[model samples]
Target chain A: DAGVTQSPTHLIKTRGQQVTLRCSPKSGHDTVSWYQQALGQGPQFIFQYYEEEERQRGNFPDRFSGHQFPNYSSELNVNALLLGDSALYLCASSLGKIVGGELFFGEGSRLTVL
Target chain B: AQKVTQAQTEISVVEKEDVTLDCVYETRDTTYYLFWYKQPPSGELVFLIRRNSFDEQNEISGRYSWNFQKSTSSFNFTITASQVVDSAVYFCALSMKTSYDKVIFGPGTSLSVIP
Candidate 1:
């Protein structure tokens, strides 16, 4: 069975530009979450999508948004990117909104905002 | 509010040595979950272990072990006979039972096992 997968392994963008990263969750999984990891730091929760709707969000600003399709695939969009936006964007998937279950993660897309 | 803190920012030890990473968390919920994940240079977070709030039993997996102490609000990880391959950024995370989708991660501890 395929695990969580993310596209655009690496990309570069300038400030004020918008970028979209994609993710396909593991088979038999319906929940998708996005995280941002800056250099030398741990992954910070961005938001989570369940049943094609956003279920929970972190402390991120409105510029960071996401969407989930019927197939459980996800997309994270960052608008008006700042230089500090440069980081590794990770996608994780789980079976549901259940607690204590393992979260399968993708390799992550490295975003460089100049 | 929930938070995870890895006290050690970085640690280095000889290949044959043993190292421990300390994690302390703060959570308001009575029922929650704790987790450990390893991230190598490749940037993917590999799930290591997960423990629920009620189960405080210490777990041992091969050369790795975890000690969960509710009294201290700390979950620590130990690697025995560490090897170079064990070098990575280790993160301790917490998720509340009420909001499992939002997993809060610690700043992470960078481990380097030198040969």
Candidate 2:
């Protein structure tokens, strides 16, 4: 089975523009998480979705939002992007044990906000 | 709040040599989980190991090993017989038992292997 997969491996957007990145979780995985990794720093969780509903969220702003499809695919939408928004958006999938489960990450979509 | 810290910003070791990467975390919660991940140049994050607050037992997997000490709040990883392919940016992550789905990552330690 395929691991977590992301779309638009790389994206270039202008300031104030909006962008949407996609992710498909690994088979048998029900939870999808989004993270933003700035250069030189580790990934920071943006949010997590389970059962097609946002189960939890991180410390990100309202501009960052997401949705989980019935098929377990997820989409991360960022609006009113700023230069600081330039970072690699990583998508990770795991089981919804409510505790800890091994995660599977995608290659990530590199978002460059100019 | 939870935080994962990797003291080493970068490390270089000769092939076949052994190297250790340190991960120090800060959290008031008594029960939580610690994890280590390897992100090679290919940019895919590979799950290496995960240790809970209760399982302090040191774990060994092939050439990889982890030492988890709750008293010190540290989970250190060591690579034995390091190979060139082992070079990558390693990240230490933490998740609380109450909210295991929410994980926080460290700054990361870049490991380089020299032939």
Candidate 3:
């Protein structure tokens, strides 16, 4: 089965602009989560979408939002991007809403905000 | 609030040597899960292992082993007879058993196995 897939492996954006990163979860998975990993750092939780609704969110600001489609695909949008927004955006998928299931991750989309 | 701490920022060892990466976590939830993910130079977060709160029994797979000590709130990983391919940024993460709970990750430990 194909694993989680993310679009636009790398992209460049300027400050105050908006960008959307897409993700297709692993086959047979329903829940999708987004994470941000800065240089030399670990992945930080952004939010999670389940059943086409946002189920959980991290400490990120309102500028960071996401949507989940019926097909279990996801999109992460960043508005008014700041220089610090530059990072690797990772998309993970799990079988259910519970936390114990193994999470399959995508290679991630690298975003550079100039 | 849930948090994870990986104390070692970076560690280097000769190819044949072994290395242990430490991870400490803090969480209020009585039932939770702990995880270890390896991020290689290719930049993919590969899931290594997962452990639940009640099941503290240590786990071993191939050359890798994990020690989970609830008494110390630590879940440490050790690589035996490490190789150059083991070089990666290892992250320790925690997630609550509650539905929709987000996973919290540590700063990660970078391991380098030099030949």
Whole-model lDDT values for every prediction: 0.95, 0.93, 0.93
Runs of candidate 3 exceeding 4 Å displacement: none
What is residue B60's positional error in candidate 2, in angstroms?
0.9
* Stretches of candidate 2 exceeding 4 Å from the true structure: none
Give the Å shift of residue A59 in candidate 3: 0.7
Q: DockQ scores for all the models shown?
A: 0.87, 0.88, 0.74
lDDT by residue for model 1 (B1-115), tens: 6889998999999998999999999998999999999999888899999999999999999999999999999999999999999999999999998888899999999999999
- Over the stretch B30-102, how does candidate 3's per-residue lDDT look in tens digits? 9999999999987889999999999999999999999999999999999999999999999999988764358
- DockQ order of candidates, best first? 2, 1, 3
Q: Is candidate 1 or candidate 2 better by DockQ?
A: 2
What TM-score should be assigned to candidate 1? 0.98
Tens-place lDDT per residue, model 1, A23-60, is 99999999999999999888999999999999999999
Q: Who is ahead in lDDT, 1 or 2?
A: 1
Find the number of clashing residue pairs for candidate 3: 0
lDDT of model 2 at residue A75? 100
- RMSD of candidate 3 to the truth, in angstroms, is 1.1
Candidate 1 stretches with Cα past 4 Å from truth are none
